[model samples]
Target chain A: MSELRTRMSAAIGTAPVEATRRGAERLAELRRRAETDYPPMGEMRDLARAIRLHTLANLHRYLSEFCESAQRAGTRVHLAADAAEANSIVESILRAAGARTVVKSKSMLTEEIGLNHALDGFRVTETDLGEFIVQIAGDRPSHIIAPVMHRTRQEIGRLFADVLGVAYTDDPPQLNDIARSHLRRRFLEADAGITGANFAVASTGSVVLVTNEGNGRMCTSLPPVHIALVGIERLVPSPAELAVLLEVLARSATGQRLSVYTTVVTGPRRPDEEDGPVETHVVLVDNGRSRVLASEDAEILACIRCGACLNVCPVYREVGGHAYGGVYPGPVGAVLQPALGVGSADLPFASSLCGACREACPVRIDIPRLLVGLRHRLVDRSSFSWLGLGLEAYSRVASNPTAWRLFLSLGSFGLRTAARDGWIGRLPFHASAWTAHRDLPGPGAPPFRVWWRNRNR
Target chain B: MSRLSEFLARIGTARLPSARPEVRAPQLDATDLVSLFIRRLEEVDGVVHRTDPVEVVAGLARRLGTDRYLSWDPDRLPVPGLVAELETLGIERHTGPGREEVPLGVTGADAGLAESGTVVLIAGPGRPRHPSLLPEVHVALLRVDLLHRSLTHWMLEHPQALSEGSGLIMITGPSRTADIEQQLNLGVHGPREVHVVLVGA
Candidate 1:
């Protein structure tokens, strides 16, 4: 346990205040531009929620419609029930295209599935600047929205100098241009471009991508064969519904009036076009979400992956996204990780249940409620072994007044005995994870419950 | 593969097995409706205009530097005099031609959606799809009334009008990118500037 803590601490060195502060400043300035340029936040949130809900409700129908329509438009539609299958389908398509090198944008789902590692035969480059930085650093993203949010500018400058064979500077503009010149060639040369879908319209057989970077357009259009790995829940019924989602997605993600590039592609480029991709493939990945969709947890599908919930979260603000140790982090990640059946129970417990995430979410997903629900699932199924079973027992006792009182009195005596040398330090092994950070306050001379009982007597 | 197939079959055959009870729809108001449309259009980086048709043309000319306007017909324009005025301002005039020869293209918007400030345009004989995308400066003549309250409203009215089998570009603004260290570079692959001329009540 100590080793794990040490590993995490070592992995996440203190964010260089000056560099991180500058990054945050840039993000804030960009956010301001987005807010000024995009529509009102409150209105966008409402529409986003509506469109998400409507899509979730009719997901299967829309997915079927989208598949049928895309097939008619000369694009192949493959359904992947899980991440492994999704990756395999893409690998097969790329192999068929004889793709030696591939260019990609930052996709959380692909990260969740560890797709880059799975591409054994091909060289894949994540073209998004933050992703590229993280890729070169040989580190995982700590934040969902900004993968390298923990890195200082000086660190990035060092990374670029080492990896790209260029002199390093902490200047943001210079770094940007360097990355642009580096990636521009990949955008033109790559045989296949892979992307994650923002929204897939079943009505029009179209995939809508909202990107501040134009890489998404080039990645989709420049290559001969284009592959989109989309989660099943990403489907909307029509183009009209897609419009509603676009309203909220930009503001929620970056506070933009609208993203600079919103591309709606139905199929491959027509024969007349000089530059569009010749083939388009949409891979709908279920991964474990269909079970979530089938269960009472279907609302989890309404997530737009805007990462707003992370921004407002107190825990995430302190620990950062990398601490969660998954592709997702914060409130949405807490609920989603388990539903996607990706990782263990530790992620669901990584929250304070303060409800700020629910408030911050544009779709107003009751994340706390969902967390509690997941906790119930975790506790009930005894899926978490001894720790979960202990919690289940505690919950049963806590629900009853007499049992709770009796248990507290006994526990209080143990706490009083455990306190020595005017301090209660070094908890038993199970509780060590908490005590490692701060000392627990000693129990009072007499339990409050004992005094209450005496007073009543 | 077999294991995956079995899993997918289970997902496909699985009924709605959720224990969650149905929730009554929340009361959504007009402001909620308008903001929803506006946010979506804006996220796609569209510009909204509230001026009259005559004023919008002036805005267009001013934005594009009163250059030569290459378009289909002068009579179809809301302000007939503005065409000659643009020509006088040294804006070149021409009908739809091959995209290679067309540097600046002007065409009519099918409808103006107020929700996101999006003006819909469909490619036809007079309007080449290439100019809507390929030109250095692409301008659309939009109408005010076509502004939709919501995407739902648009769908309810037009149904599947947006589904283009070959090409469908629902453009919100000038093509832009943040790929280079998240710095915005406008006119990367598409038009550098998108000028909108609102032409109606």
Candidate 2:
């Protein structure tokens, strides 16, 4: 809690002001456009939710179906039970191909597994600009969708100037040009490519990546060997369901009618095809998703990695993504941290429980409920702490009217020196944690029981 | 038990087993699909031109510059003599992952999405995936009849089409990125401009 409080307070000035502003504006525009552009978005979300729930309910069947279909379509499917296994599988695939240089698209699952840390011998390049920026800075992604959302343009310009030995320009198009020139060479020279899946259609054996930048296409097409690391929960039962997810994913993520490229690949390059990867490997990584699938918090598995929840979260807007201290951040990260046992247990308490995240979620995950559940598990399911001791003592007092009245009178008498203008400017001792940000009024009114008795008379 | 089997067994034990319900997407009926497609394409910063097959080729020749041009193989070309016509018009048609500096490239769409103005291209003998991408400007000649109501409708009708073992790329607009301060810069790493020439009126 100390560390969490420190990071959160530190994030006051560092929150992404411009990026969050732009995201908020774009999301409002998306909602307006969605009414006329697509069918009723609410009904569509219901369909999307049902589809995800169905897939999760029958995840094993769907995953197995995906494997069989992908194998039939000429992709070699490997099941990795954990992050270590997933990373090793990727390493072996690259090793067998004698891959020296590898180009990778932005994959959060890869970050979750710490894949880049294991590849000591290979030159790996992150093709996406946001991802490339983070990789160069030796930082993890702050926002799931916009990896470098926390960094301002000027900050990025300075970083580029310092690192890439190029002229600094805050101009986005110029920054884009610099990144394109930088990554274009990597794409050509790399022997293998890796990407994350937006949705995996089980019945069709297709790996779909919804991306605005064409880096996903480049990673899938340019290299001789392509390996896709897909979360097991990413699977959908059919192409029809894939369509449903795609409809909501882009609109929810960046508020686009469609992302620039939806690279739907069934397998590696076919016999008659000329350009795609020579050998394709599909790595199905559970990495704690199965545990989530079994848990009462299974609705969190309905996430499509859209980042809409992040956009609308009040606390995220204030504290920003880095404060979450995990591969994921925002409202979605708050749930995953506790669910996967990855990051701080204090994450669930980070939110205001406003339910904005649930409203913004495309699949309608009850994020606040999950947050409450985690909080309940943390306090009730643990050994006694100072707060617990205080609560136990207070419970005894609260149970007896005489003791409660006596305690309140003693507290009021003890606070006489601290009281000024019917308010305590700052609380004394451990209670200062509350008064640090807010002033506490000195017993402004009679206690509830006293007021109740007087009002009835 | 194998990890896969064990996972399935765990799923079997966890919670009340729910049936996988059939998901059907709501349909949007556009009185004029071609018009709807054009409007949607325009909204996404994609340019669209509607003309007859001859104009499709000739208009492509006229407006789209004839420099470092790459088109789908002869079989995938819309008209039989489109390749010859382009060559006659002094457009240099090359093959096989040309230098990264592709100025313009052409291909035909297997399906056109009216809902989002997406063009679906599948990798095959004539239609390699490279030409549609890599270039700064991509010219996709879509047949009017191939236009579908929505992506869902297309999938529902052609479920097996996905598992046909080809690289299918669905493009709604040119390659774009808003990652930097959420300011969108089109044609980042992929094509900068995508022009859909509706082959038939």
Instruction: Give the top-scoring candidate (lDDT).
Output: 2
Q: Candidate 1: TM-score? A: 0.73
TM-score of chain A of 2: 0.93
Q: Which 10-residue window of candidate 1 chain B scores lowest in summed lDDT? A: B17-26
Q: For model 2, how does the per-residue alpha-carbon lDDT over B89-134 read when each residue is reduced to its tens digit?
A: 6666776455466567789888998888899988877788888887
Model 2, which residues run further than 4 Å from truth?
Answer: A15-37, A386-389, A444-457, B1-17, B52-66, B96-99
Clashes of 2: 0
lDDT of 2 by residue, A1-457 (tens): 5788788888766547446545655654665466456655677788888888888888878887887888888898888888999899999999899999999999988988888888867899999889999998887777788888767889889889999999989999999999988898899888999998999989878899977889999999989999999998899988888887888887787777668899888888877777789899999888888888778777788899988888788788777778888788889999986798898889999999999899888888889999998888888877868888988999999999899889988887767658888878788788898899888877746666678999999
Question: Global lDDT of each model?
Answer: 0.67, 0.82
C-alpha RMSD between model 2 and the true structure:
2.6
**Candidates' DockQ values?**
0.19, 0.64
> Is model 2 an incorrect, acceptable, medium or high docking prediction?
medium
lDDT of 1 at A453: 78
Question: What is the TM-score of each predicted model, taking all chains together?
Answer: 0.73, 0.94
